[model samples]
Structures are given as structure tokens and as C-alpha cells.
Target: MEYADSKCNAYDTYASEAKLYPCLPPVVVPSAPELIRVEGSAQSYRLQKINEIQKEIATERDKHANLSKKYHRAVRIVAGVDNALVVSSMVLDATGIGVLSTIIAVAIATEGAAFG
Candidate 1:
């Protein structure tokens, strides 16, 4: 506009240029807290470790209960077999001495094997 002779055009160009200039001051962003952030990260890690131990304990309890059930089942089978042997012994009492003796020997062998 320096070369222009008209005052009106020069004023319009100056007005437009002034509008491009910044009116408000620059913004200042706040800095983050370094020590506090570090502490918070450590605390979260500790909580995660504690939670993992609790999960392990719950799993162990379930394993123990399952093992107990299997042990009881084996005990029941042993008891049933022992009872059958006792009933058979009673019925064989009047048989020939030789046969009765053989049954008794077999029963003793079976009981010893089962008890072991």
C-alpha cells in the first residue's frame, strides 16, 4: 500500500493486517508431578502382586478338596471288597476241610494285598 495514493485502500489493508496479529497472551501449561506419579505406579504394582497370591490360594484349596474326594472313593472300594470276603467266609464254613482251608488261604492273601 506504500505505492498507493488512495487513503481509503491503505486504511483497509492496514485494518486487515492488524486482525492477523495475536490479541491474547500465550498460554502456560502446568507441569506434571514427577515423584507422585512414580509412587502411584509402585502402589499399583504391589496391589497386583497381592491379588495374584490370593488367586493361588483359592486354586490350592480346590486341588485339596478334589484329592480328598478321590481318597474317600478308594477307601470305599477297599471296604466293599473286605466285606465281600467276610460274607464268603461265613458261607464256606460247612464245606470239605480241604476246600475251606484253600478259601481261607486265598482270603488272607487278598486282605494282605489290599491293606498294603
Candidate 2:
């Protein structure tokens, strides 16, 4: 009985001297409603930015289309003028007039200067 009592007392003394470590507190979290509101606002902002980008792309596409149309029209006009020059030169050569060669040379030089 005396030995058992001594052993029990020693255990109690060791238990009292034991060191305890502190634990970190749990992290705080937002409620469901608050989370929903934050997410909704973020989503709306993203959507608005996407729409702005889309509008910019559409505007650029329209500008490109207009430029393409102007370029094609200019090419057609140049082609028609070139054809007219060829026909006039042919008619002058076929006539074989005395001053026709000089006139043809002047016409060709003028066309070259204007185009080049």
C-alpha cells in the first residue's frame, strides 16, 4: 500500500509539471450571403469589361471593311483608266497619221509619270 501511494504521488507531480502548447484560433469565414454578394459584383465587372472589348473589336472590324471596299474601288478605277489608254494608243497607231507617233510617245510618257 505504501509503495503504491508513492508511485501515484510521483505520477501526479510529473503531470503537474507537464508543459502545454497553445493552439492557433480557427480562421474567420464570410457568411453565405456576403460571399454571394462579392461573387456577383465580381462577375458583373468581368462581364462589363468583356462587352467593352467586344464592342471595340466590332468597331475595328467595321473600319477594316470600309478600308477594304475603298481599296477595291480604287483598283477598279485604275484598271478602267489603263484600259482606256491602251485603246486610244491602238487607235492612233492604226490611223498612221504623220504626227501620230509623237502623240503616242507623249501619251505613254504622261501615263508613266502619273502612275509611277
| Candidate with the greatest TM-score versus the true structure | 2
Clashing pairs in 1: none
Clashes of 1: 0
TM-scores for all predictions: 0.47, 0.49
Write one digit per residue (lDDT tens) for candidate 2, span 1-116.
23454433333335555335423458899767544345888989999999999999999999999999999999999999999999999988777774788799999999999999
For 21-83, candidate 1 gives per-residue lDDT tens digits of 344569899998676455877999999999999999999999999999999999999999999
For residue 41, model 2's alpha carbon misses the true position, in angstroms, by: 1.7
**How displaced is residue 49 in candidate 2, in Å?**
1.0
